[model samples]
Target: MDTSAAARASVCRLPRSVVTSVHTPVSPVGRHLVLMALCFPSASMCPKGCICQRDPHLHSLNVTCSQSRLKEIPPTLPVDAVLLRLDHNQIGAVPDQAFRGLRVVRELNLSYNAVETLGEGAFIGLEESLQVLDLSHNHITRVHRDVFARLKARVIVDDNPWHCDCALQQAISGMAHNHEAAARVLCRSSDLLDQDGRPFLAVEIDLCNLAKRTTDYAMLVTMFGWFAMVISYVVYYVRQNQEDARRHLEYLKSLPSKPKKPDEADDISTVV
Candidate 1:
C-alpha cells in the first residue's frame, strides 16, 4: 500500500458518529453508503487494506484487518466469513453487537490488542461457529464466565496478568476450560511467588475445588458412620434382651413341682 497508488482516504461522516477513513472516490453520501455496506457485506465492500478470501478449507470466507492502526473493529465484514484475523491493533473495547452478525466465524484472532473488557452479549451469537479464540497479550484481567461457556474452541488466553481467584475458577469450570487458556495464565499477585511459573489450572485452583468436594464427602461419611453406630447399638441391646428372656424361661422350667409328691405322703400319714 504505497502513497501514490493508495486510494485517497476519505472521512465518512455520519449523522452522530464519524466512520473510519477509507479509499473512496465518491460523494459523502456514497461514503456513508460504503460504510453501511460493510456491515454484513461482501468482501469487495471492505475498506482499502482489508484482506478477504473464501474459505478454501471449509468453503466459507476469511477476513483480515490487521495492524492498520485500527482503534476499532471494522464494522463491515462478510457475513459468511469463517476466519477473522484482527491482530496487532489498538481495539480497546468490544461493543455489544460487534460480532453478532458473524455467525459462522470459526478462527478469530484479536491478539495483541488493548481489549480490556468485552461487553455483555459481545459474543452472544458466536457459541456455535467460534472454534479458535485468540485473546493473548491483552489487558484483560477478569472475564465473564459465560463468554466461553458454550464455545468448544482452543482459546488462547496466554500472556495476560490473571488474578487467580473464585471468579476465574468458576468461569473455566466445565466444558469451558480450555487447557491452553489456563496453561499460560500468569499470576498477578506480587506476594504469590510460588505460583509464578505455574499455570492456573495446575495448582491450588483444582485442589481448592477438590478440597471443598472432599470436605463435603467427609461430612457425608461422618453422618453415615454415626447412623451405623446407632443401628449397631440398638441391635446389640435387642439381642441381649432376647438372651435374658430365654434364660428366665429356662430357670422357670427347671424349678420342679415339689408339692406334688408331698400330697401323697400327707395322706399316708393321716391313715396311720
Candidate 2:
C-alpha cells in the first residue's frame, strides 16, 4: 500500500480514547477556563453598569453597583448574588418586592441614596438570608409599620430624615426585637422641636396613645356633627308636616255649608 494509505490505516487501529486525547489536548489555561465556567455559570449575567465577581473562597457572588446613578433597582439581577452594594445612587423609591428575586443576598447596602420611601414588600425575598441592611443617609421620612417588622437583619438607618410621629413610633416599636436597628434610629424632624436631633428610642412621649386620643376626639366630633344634622332634619320634617296639616284644616273651614233641605226645615217647624 502507498504511505498515505498505510498511515491512515495505522491511525484507525488506535483506541478511541487514545485518539481523542491525542487530538484534543487541553492546556492549563484552557482547563482553568473550563473550571471557571463550571463554577460560575451565571457570571456572564452581570447587570449593566454593575461589577460582578465570584468569591472563590466563599463560593458567593458579589454585585457592586454603587455610584452608578441608578434610578431604580436593576430588573435583572443574578439570583446567586450574596452581597449587593447599591449605595450612592439616586433610587428614589423602593416599590413592593423590589428585591424579590434576590433570595440569597445577605448584605445589602442602600445607603446614601435618595430613597424616600420603603414599600412594604421591598425586601420580601431577602427576609431569610439578609443579614445586614445599610439604609443610612437617605431621605426616608416615614415607613409603613410592617416594613421592617419581618426583617431580622442588622439594619443601619442613621442620618435619615425620619419624622418622629405616631406612625414612626409604631414602626419602631414593631421592630423592637431588632434592638440595634431601633436604637440607631434618630429623629431628624418632629412636631415638637425638643424631640428633633434626638434618638427615636430616647423620646419619652407616648405618641401612639396621643394619636389614639386624637383619633377618638375626631370620631366624637364627627359623630356629634352627624347627630346634630339628623336632629335638624327630623325637626324640619315635623314642622313641614304640621304646616301642611294646618293648611288642610283651613281649606275645609273655608268651604260653604250645604243649605238645609226645605223638607228638613218643615219637619223641624212641625216638631216645634
Candidate 3:
C-alpha cells in the first residue's frame, strides 16, 4: 500500500471519542439550546395563552395559564405536564374527566376561578399522581360526596360559598388527608341562619340525622296523601251506592199498582 493510504488507515483506527474531540467544542449556550429542544414541548403543542416550561430538577413540564381569561379549560393540554396552574381565570365549572389526558399532573391550581360545582370524576386521571389541589376562593356551593373521596391529595377548599348540609359534610369528611382543611371549612349556608358562617366541623348539629328526619317527614306526608285519597274514594263509593238504592225505590213507587185480579174482585163483591 502507498504511504497516504496507510496514514488514512491509521486515522480511521482512532477511538470514536478522540475523533469527536478533534471537532470544535459546543458552547454552553448551544448545549442549553439542545437540552431545551429535547425536554420542552413544541410551541404548537402548548395551549394558547399559556406558558410551558420544563422543570430541570423534576424533568417534567410545568404549564401555567393563570389569569388568562379562560372561560373554560383548554381542550388540548400538554400530556407530559406535571404542574398546571389555571388560577385567576374565569372558568365556571369543572366537567367530568376534565383532566383525563393529563395523567402525570402532580399539582393543580384552580383557585380564584368561578367554579361553582365539581362534577363526579372531575379529577379522574389525577388520583394516583396528584399531590396538591388548590381550589380556594371560588364560588363553590355544593359538591358530591364521591367527588373528592378518591383523591388522596391535600385539598384546599376554603373561601367558598359551601352549603354546609349533609352532602357537604359527607364530602368534607371524605378527605382523609385534608383534615385540617376540612376543619376550616365554614358554612356559607345552612338550614338555620345561626349556623351560617361557622366552621362546618365545629357546628353542633348532626347533619345526617337532620337529613334522615327530613326524609322521614317527606315519607309521612306522602303516606298521608295516599291515605286521604283512599278515604275520599270510599266516601264517594258509599254515597254513590245510597243514591242508586234511592233511585230504584223511586222507580218502584212510580209504577202504578196492578189492579186486583178479576176473580178476586168478584169474590170480594159476592161476600159483601
Candidate 4:
C-alpha cells in the first residue's frame, strides 16, 4: 500500500458536500441585482455624448441624446425612463420593437434625424403610455397609415418633404376627422403651400390637387381638339374653292370657241 500517495490524494480531495458549499449556486437576489444593472443603467451607464437628468419642467426622468450623431439607440436605457430625446442624429430607420424596453416612456423626442423608413409597428409598444412624440425635421416624406394609429399624443411632423400623392390623400383626409390628432399632426412639408407657416392642415389640398391636374389635362386636350378641327375646316374650305375654280375653268375650255364675225374671218384668212 503506497501510504504516501494515499495521504497525498486524501489531502488534495474534499467531500462532495464540502466542495458544493465552497461553490454555491447564484441566489435569486443576485440575479435580480444583475437584471437591475442591465435594466436601470445609472449615471455610469449614460454616455458623455448625451445628457440624462430630471427636469422640473417635465417632472420626469429626461434623457436627451440629441445631436450626438448616434446611428443607433442608446444601449441599456433605464426601463423607468420617461422623456427620451434623440433628435438630430444620423439614425436612418426605427426598427420594429425597438422601444419595447422603454415601458414607462411618456414623451419620446426623435426629431431631426435622417429617418427614411419607420418600421411597421415600430412604436406600437409605447401606444398606451406615450404622451408626446416629436418627429419633426426629418427626411421622412411619408409615414405608414398605421404608424400613428395607437399613439394619442402631441405629434409634430413638420419640415418634411411630403410627396402629397394618391396614397397620402386618404390618410391625410382621415386625420382631419380626429381634431385632436389632426391638430397634433403638424405637417409642415413644403408640399403644403400654406404661406402662413402654421402647421399646415390642408390634406384637402393633396386630395384636390390630383383632381385639379386631371381636369386641367382634360381641358388642354379639348382645346387642342378644337384648334385642330378649326384648322381642318379652314383647309377643307379653301381646297374646295380651288377645286370649284379649276372645274369652272375646265368647263369653259370644253365649250366651243365663240364664232368670229365674217369680216374677222376674212381678215384672218387673208393674214393666213
Candidate 5:
C-alpha cells in the first residue's frame, strides 16, 4: 500500500484518546486518523509472498507458512492462529518455545521433514484446544518419556526409527500400554527381537538384567554352583557301575571241578 493509504489504515483502528502530528485536524475522527499514523507508521505492509489479512481456510487456522526452504522456525508467528503445517522442509530441531503465544493451535502437522530430535518438555504449555498431533516421517529416534505428559489430546507418531535400548526402555514400555491414549505407534530397535517372527517389539529383559547383576560376588556364586552339581553326579555314577561288575566275576570262580574225579574212579575199579 502507498504512504497515504497505509497511514489511513493504521490510524482508523486506534482508540479516541491519542493525538496526531501529520495533520492538526480539529474533529475527533481526523484526530484519531492522524494519531494512528504517528504511532504506527508501517502496519499495512505484508511479508513477501504472505498477506497480513485474516485467513479464511480454517476458522481458527489463520496463518500458514509451509513448503518453504526454512532451516529454522520463524520467530514471529500469529499467536491466535490454530492449525500450522510445516511439512516437507529442512527443519532439524524445534525450539521448546517456538509456538510461544499460539494458545489456540489445534492441529499441527510436522511430517515429511528432517526433525532428528525433540527437546524435553517441548510442548509443555500449549493451547488447551490442541487435539491432533502429527509427527510422522521424521528422523526422530526417541521420544522423551515425560515429554507428552501435559498434552491433553491424541498423538500420532509412526514411521520413525525408534531406539529401543536401555535408554529407550521407558518410552517403549509407555507406548505398549498406551491403548487408550497413544494411537498407531511403531518403534523399531536393535535390541528388540521377535521370537515368533511377530511384528511386536520385544525386550531382552533376561539379557539386560543378567548383565546388570554380574558383579564379582554374584559371579563367584554362579561359578561354584555348576561345578558342585555336575562333577558330583558323574563321579558317583561311574563308581557304582564298577562295583557291580567285580561282584559278578567272584561268583563264577566259586564253582567246583567234579567231573575229572568221576573218570579216575572208573579206571581204578577196572584194574582191580
Candidate 6:
C-alpha cells in the first residue's frame, strides 16, 4: 500500500471506545431545552392571530392569551397548563369536546368575549379537578341547567344577559341553592331590558315594564278573586245574623212577659 493510503487507513481505524467517549448522548436537560424552543419559537410567540405567553417558572404551568381574534379555541394548548387566561376573544361557544384532554386545568378566565350561546352539555367531560370558572362579560343569553350540572367549581357569571322568564326560572332557582354560586347577576342586553335604564331584579321589576305589568295583572286577578270570596262570606254571615236577630226578637214578642199577673193588670186598669 502507498504511504498516503496507509496513513488514512490508520486514522480511520481509531478505537470505537474513543469515538463513543467523544460523542456522548445528549443530556436530558439539553433535550428538554431543544423541545421547548421547538414548541415555542419565542418567549411571546403566539399564532399569527393570537396573543399568548408561557410562564417563566419551570415548576408552574401558567399561560396568558388574550385580545386575539380567535373565532374558536386553539387545539394544541399545553396539557400541563394549570392557570389559563383567554379573554377579549371572539369565541362564540365552547363545544362539548373543547376540554377533552386537558386534565390539569384549574383556573380558567373566559371574559370579555362574544360567547352568545353555550351549547347544552358543552362541558360534559372536563377534568374533575377544575375549579374557579370565570365567565364574566359576554353575550350569554341564558344558562342551561345542564351547564351547571356538569361543573363542581365556584362559578363567577356576572355581566351577562340573563333572561328571567319561565325558561330561566329553574336555572335561577337551582343557582339559589348552590353555595359556590355568585350573587351578582345582571342583564347586559338593552333589548332585553325595558325603557328604564335599571337592571332586571325584583326591586327593578318596572325595568321590564311589560313583564311587570303582566305579573301585576295576574296578581290583581288573584286578589280580586279572593276579595270577592271574602265579601260573599261576609254578606252571608251578616244576613244570617240579621235573620237570627229578627227571629229572636219575634220570639221575645211572642212570649207573654210574665203574663202581667191578673192582680197587676187590675191595678193598672183602676189607675187608668
**Best-performing candidate as measured by TM-score:** 3
Over 1-272, each residue of candidate 5 has an lDDT whose tens digit, in order, gives: 23553455453444334323334434556555555444433323322333333443333434445677666666766565566677777889776866677688787777888888787656765737668767778888766765665666556666677654444454444554344433334446545455223222443464345445655558888889989889998988888888777777777777775576876898989888
How many steric overlaps are in each model, in order?
3, 0, 0, 0, 0, 0
How does each model score on TM-score? 0.55, 0.76, 0.80, 0.51, 0.53, 0.52
- Over the stretch 1-272, how does candidate 2's per-residue lDDT look in tens digits? 23443343343343444334333266545544544555566777888999998775686899999999899989888899999999999999999998877889999999999999899878898888999999999999988888887887888888898999887887787777677888988888985568888999998988888778878999999999999999999999999999999999999999999999999999999999
lDDT of 6 by residue, 50-122 (tens): 4345554444466676876777777666666667778888889877667666677788888898887776666
Give the alpha-carbon lDDT of every model: 0.71, 0.83, 0.83, 0.67, 0.59, 0.63
Name the better of 2 and 6 by TM-score: 2
What lDDT does model 3 reach?
A: 0.83
User: Comparing 4 and 6 by TM-score, which wins?
Assistant: 6
User: Which candidate leads in lDDT?
Assistant: 3
Clashes of 3: 0
Candidate 1 per-residue C-alpha lDDT over 1-272 given as tens digits, one digit per residue, 9 for 90 to 100: 22322222222123333333533455656654565454324756565568886543455667888887888877777778888898999988877768878888889999999998877567778888888889899888777655667677788888877766555666667344576566667766422347655667666546446657877999999999999999999999999999999999999999987665887989999999
TM-score of 2: 0.76
Best-first order by lDDT: 3, 2, 1, 4, 6, 5
TM-score of 1: 0.55
Residue-wise lDDT of candidate 4 within 1-272, one digit each (tens)? 13442342244343444334322265645534433443334556565688887544454567889889898766667566788889889988887877877778988988889887787678867977887877777777666666776676666665665555444454454455356544444443444455233444545455456667877999999999999999999999999999999999999999999877999988989999
For residues 1-272, what per-residue lDDT tens digits would candidate 3 score against the true structure? Answer: 23443343243354445334433375645544433444354445788999998765566788999989999988889898899999999999999989988888899999999999798889998989999999999999989888998898999999999888888878887996798989879988996568889999887778988989999999999999999999999999999999999999999999999989999999999999
Ranking by TM-score: 3, 2, 1, 5, 6, 4
User: Clashing pairs in model 6?
Assistant: none
What C-alpha lDDT, on a 0 to 100 scale, does residue 237 get in candidate 6? 100
Q: How far out, in Å, is residue 102 in model 6?
A: 1.2
